[model samples]
Target: MIEEPGRVVAIEREAVWIEALDEAACPGCTASVGCGRWSFDWLETPRRRRRIRALSVMPLRVGDAVVVGIREDFLLRSTLAIYLLPLLGLFVCTIAIQQLGFGESLMIPAGFLGFVSVWAMVRRISRRQMNDPTLQPVVLRALPGASEGQVRQAAF
Candidate 1:
């Protein structure tokens, strides 16, 4: 399971909406002390916070700290589907066009068509899986020390 710390921002009957905590920036590489990367500090920009709703089995309240997680297999499968499938489609289409002796002129168009088709297929599959539990993030556990009384008092 891949887990991240988040805070419950809202509560539904069976789910909690969480705001993920932004992790600290990574430490510098091997040449840290003398690295020139810091010179490009201006290039860095603040990113929008990610908010997600996760199924929870335990009682939760807004302001509660929690751990959210998703399966590793789910993460890997999504990464491959988004990045690799399109390239594979492009190459296969180009190769097929070449084999048919349609000339190089049609290669670009054929590859584009294949890429778009595969993207549409992937999109359809993902839409169908919008409610799939395996692909959805879940509330793994609540962090200790945040009392429900305290959260309730704070909510007002």
Candidate 2:
């Protein structure tokens, strides 16, 4: 299970809202800042809060810790809906436009533009969905020893 520590920002009867602690240092880095890439460290600074929603598995209070991520099936379904639906719409629209007896000059450009528009819309929707923290699933809960300060401490 891919798990990350987060603090409970809100607690409801059926759901819990947790905010993931941002890492101060780039977790992707392997170096000790000996390289010339220290200039990029500014980009690695953590944000203040990232709210996530989860089904309440345990009685959690405000300021508790939790982890969030989608199940594999849910992730797959989300990807297909976000990606394949637009492509299918593009394909169907193109075919319908071609069969409508419009001239190639008009039909081709319209079809191409339709496909592009669908692709652009998919991208926009995907970005918007990614911005919604509630879409993500809560997969695990952190132990009582987990410290938000430790998670936010910069390694560089």
Candidate 3:
């Protein structure tokens, strides 16, 4: 279980909403600057609040400090579904298109298009999966010992 410290932004009868704290790391002298990768990371680094609804385990107040656990298996499964499935779909679709009795020109374009279609479908499925409460990482435990003030200032 990978635990992340978060603040309880809102508390309802059935669920608790939490915004995760951001952890920063300096990318050492890798000359990643000016690259698209660097720019993307820079854009996303500041927006790190992850709004999550968790099962109401205890009577959590709005400023409570809680620990959210992301199970390893859940992360692995999510990564595979999002990244590998799309590549696998592309490969399977390409092979299937090749076996169909079409001219090379049509086969190539059709296979490419089919791969794109499957990739799009996989992306859609991933989005839906992420929104599922069951699929969202579980809250294994919460530290009720911490004071409300401490919870607010706790580091992730």
Q: Go through the candidates in order and give each one's C-alpha lDDT.
A: 0.76, 0.65, 0.68
Clashes of each: 0, 1, 0
lDDT of 1 by residue, 1-156 (tens): 877667899998778899863433333255544556545544555333579989888998788888788889988998899889988999999999999999888999999998988888888998999887668889988875655444222322
- Candidate 1, residue 101: lDDT: 92
Winner by lDDT: 1
Candidate 2 accuracy as TM-score: 0.59
Question: Over 4 Å off in model 2, which ranges?
Answer: 22-26, 29-48, 104-136, 149-156
Instruction: Tell me the tens digit of each residue's lDDT in model 3 across 21-118.
Output: 55432324366675565667677866466687776667778777787767778888777866787667666766776787656777667667766787
TM-score to native of every candidate shown:
0.78, 0.59, 0.65
Better of 1 and 3 by lDDT: 1
Candidate number that wins on lDDT, 2 or 3: 3
lDDT of 1: 0.76
TM-score for candidate 1: 0.78
Query: Model 2, residue 116: what's the lDDT?
Result: 79
